[model samples]
Target: MCGIFGYVGDESAGPIVYRGLETLEYRGYDSAGVALRSGGSDELTIEKRAGEVAALSVPTVPDAISAIGHTRWSTHGAPTDENAHPHTGCDDRLAIVHNGIVENYEAAKADLDEHTFTSETDTEVVAHLLERELDSLEESGPDSPPRDGSPGRPDGGTASREGESADAPDSSDVAWRVRRALESVVDRLDGSYAIAAIHERDDCIVATRNESPLVVGHGSNAAFLASDVPALVEHTREVTYLDDGDVAVLTPDSVSIYRDGRRVEPSISTVEWDADAAQKGGYDHYMRKEIHEQPTALRQALGSRVDVDTGTASLDVDFPQGYLESVEEVQFLACGTSAYAGRYAATLFESLADVRATSVTASEYAFTGGRDPWRTLAVAVTQSGETADTLSALREARGAGARTLGVTNTLGSSVTREADDALFIRAGPEIGVAATKTFASQVSTLALLAIAVGRERGTLTAATAREHLEDLTALPGAIQQVLDREEQIRAVATTFADSDAFFFVGRSYGYPVALEGALKLKEISYDHAEGFPAGELKHGPLALVTDETPVLAVLTDGAGRRESLNNVAEVQARGAPTIGVTTAGVDAGSLDVAFEVPDAGVFSPLVANVYFQLFAYHVANEKGRSIDKPRNLAKSVTVE
Candidate 1:
């Protein structure tokens, strides 16, 4: 995935665009570039480089009123200066910044034999194609004006014949010409993309999207466009999300949207979080700040949705009456940390609601084995809600006649519009490439979903449901208690930072936590790590254990604590040091290092996860790793 930002305003365009790119750097950091158009000029000034946003040197263009920038995650070519975005035509009259892939770029390039290709990128073809379309229009009809300051005839001549006066075409406006050229260019291209183009003669930015995300921000005497909300939150909270085939013309005064060459109105929504939420807030890194914010994030997730007295949850999801009673299976579709959240939810659904449930990686999802679509409910879990694989799986499930629900933290994300019902996690902005707070919020929200489903199915008694509700209400405090002992976890991480490898072992609900813990360590620390069900250690993984390797065991209550402790002893027998995350009064004499967590019944393992997150953060900090933007990892996976 790549990030795109465009601005047209009274203020200097270069600085505003550069700042927006900085906020979106987590989405893509391979390269950065900007294209600026000064007032009353048709010549664009371009600056680009093959590195992070901080590496790019933005020129001071005080009078530049329009600009478009991009931070790229390379797809077609290596991250080089030649491959960086803000691609221009041979004449350099127009500049374009693109985000997604052009699947049929090879075919499109073959047709544009008259244009000289510069870089090895699918995006460059779009610029050349638009250039060619504009040139053709100037040659074939009087409906377009030549770029040079000259009055032209329908023929390739600048002067008219004797006794003949040439009249300017009605559609000779710069915006009209650019829009027509772009429409022609897009018709010849294939695949997902969010493209913003600026011409030297036009003081506006023409942007369009197909299967990729683009948001238009409305501000005082300004207009902004970005791939995500973080880039626009500072400028304006009000935004309009662009849908497929929607083209928007953004000027300093107004934004006009069109689809299929006809005007259309799009609803504008305000982002709930502000720019400060995206900052590290005084922490060493974004990952650390998000880790400590877990308590508040969990409280927001549980806000007013759960009723402890009634032993029920009102998630504001509108499913048909009697729909929960008719459900025979619950299938969760997700990827990465969200997949781990889904795995945790699957266990709770089966245990609490007495239903058959399974978690499937979204990329490998299939609705097979003769399952009845009407009786099957598919839930898609994602933090950004724009994850391509999960959206693909959701579409497949909906096409097969299954009612789908989306659980995500973003309000206007694609998942909210595509699914039949949507549940917001309300975790706020998470800027770290390695997920921390969103994972906790996803699990807490899904736990509430399980409670509601159990009550609807009549499988859980009122007192039992109330007990689970009480544990949830106490979850925020439990996580806070773990956050208070951050120094102890940091100390443990310092000792194990030099270890050859790491292993995390747990069972039941703890299994997903162990998997998520290992993911966080490997993602940020760049360490060798693996996670397994505690019982599987003896089957094959035990041979890899040694004193040089440190094993972390999740021994919290209600997550097979006794069984995991036995596995910890097995690791100790193999001469491997064991670190146990347990509750109070647990026998942890066999563990080399033990961190006590607050007791909250089944949610204790979630509290234990905070220790794992802090340990990973400290280990990466010790190794001098880039914890916020880990190498080769982008924040959101927008491409399949």
Candidate 2:
């Protein structure tokens, strides 16, 4: 995935766009660039590089009022200065920055054989296409005379030449031509994209999106555009998320949205969180701050929605009447951490709701298997709400006539618009590439959903529902208790920092936590780790156990602790040092190192996850790893 930002305002454009790119650093990019247009200028000033955004040298452009920038994660070519974004047209009058793949870029490039291509990026084809369209328009002459009373280009060529402004096109004419050219360019392209372009002769920015995210920020005497909210939170809280096939024109005064050549209006939402939420908040790393923010995040996820006394949860999800009652099965579609969270939810739903449930990896999702669409409920779980795979799976389910629900942390994300209904996790902005707080919030919110569904289906009795709700209400405090023992976790993690490999084994609900634990460690620490069901160890994985391979076991109550302990003993017998996260009063002598988890019934395993997160964080911290922006990972995956 790549990040794109654009601004048209009274202030200098270069620094504002550069700052926006910095806020999007968590999206993970290898190269960055910016293009700026000064007042009354007919040429774009472009600067780009092949490394970090901090390394990019952005020159000061006095009176510059419009700009666009990009941080690219290479897809078609290697990360090089030549491959960086803000690509220009043949005349260097138009600059464009793009995110997402152009599937037919080769065909488009071939069609424009006369245009000189400079880079190996699929995005470069769009600039050339726009140039061709503009050239055609110049050859045919303006349909209407220039509104500014300036003469048209009589030579039937590009309007401006180096050090020559005698035949420069009027600003209004240039803007009109750029808009028409962009529409033509989009028609020629296929596949997902979020594109933004600026012409030196135009005083506005033109942008569009299809299957990729683009948000327009409304500010005083200014307009802004970015791929995500974090980039615009500081400048403007009010935003309008563009829909597919919608082209947006941003000027200093207003934002004009058009679709299929007709002007349209889109709803605007105010960002609830401020810029401070995206910062580290005085922590050494975003991962650490987010890990520690779990308590507050859990509280936000719960809020007043859970009523332990009545054994009910008001999630504000507008499911159709009797929808919960008509559900014959529940299917969760997700990927990566959200997939693990779904695994946990699926198990809970089956056990508590007396319903058949399954978790499908969204990328591998299929709607077949003789399932009835009318009786099936498909739930898409994603933290960012823009995950490409999960969104695809949701669309597939909906196309099959299944009722689709989106569970996500972001407000006004693509998932919210695409799904029939949406439930917010309210976990706030998570900037860390390695997820921490969102995982906790996702599980907690899903747990609430399961409770509400079970109650509505009459499968769970009031007493059972009350007990589970009570456990959930106490979960935030239990996680805080675990957070209080950070020093102990740090010590154990440091001791095993030099271990050759790590193995995590658990049973029941803990199985998903074990998998997530291994994922966190490998993602941030760059360590070798594996996680599987505790019983499966003896089947084959036990052979990998040795003195140098430490095994971490989840031994919390109500999650098959006794059976998991037997597997712990199996690893210990192979000379593997064992660490256990268990409930208080569990036999600590059986573990080489043990972390106490507060008693919270089935939720104790979730509390134990805090220990795993701390262990992963400290280990990565000790190894001097990039804990916030892990290599080759983006915070929000906007591309498939």
Q: How well is each residue in 1-640 modelled by candidate 1, as lDDT tens digits?
A: 8999999989899999999999999989999999999775567989999999999987578899899999999999999999999998888888999988899999998998878988999999999988887777656455334443323342334453343332222122566567767766887678888999999887889889887889999999999999999999988999999888888888888787877655566679989888899887898899999988998998899999988998988888988999999999999999999999999999999999999999999999998989999999999999998998999999999999999999998878889989999999999999999999999999999999999999989998889899998998898898888889998888989999999999998899899999999999999999999989999999999999999999998999867998888898888998998998999777776799999887888888898899999999999999999888899999989888
Name the 10 consecutive residues with the lowest summed lDDT in model 2.
145-154
Worst 10 residues of 1 by lDDT: 163-172
Score candidate 1 by TM-score against the native: 0.95
RMSD, each candidate, Å? 5.1, 5.3
Q: Could you tell me how far off, in angstroms, the CA of residue 46 lies in candidate 1 after the best superposition?
A: 0.7
- As a whole number from 0 to 100, the lDDT of residue 154 in candidate 1 is 28
Task: Give lDDT: candidate 1, residue 397.
Answer: 97
TM-score of 2: 0.94
Q: What's the TM-score of every candidate structure?
A: 0.95, 0.94
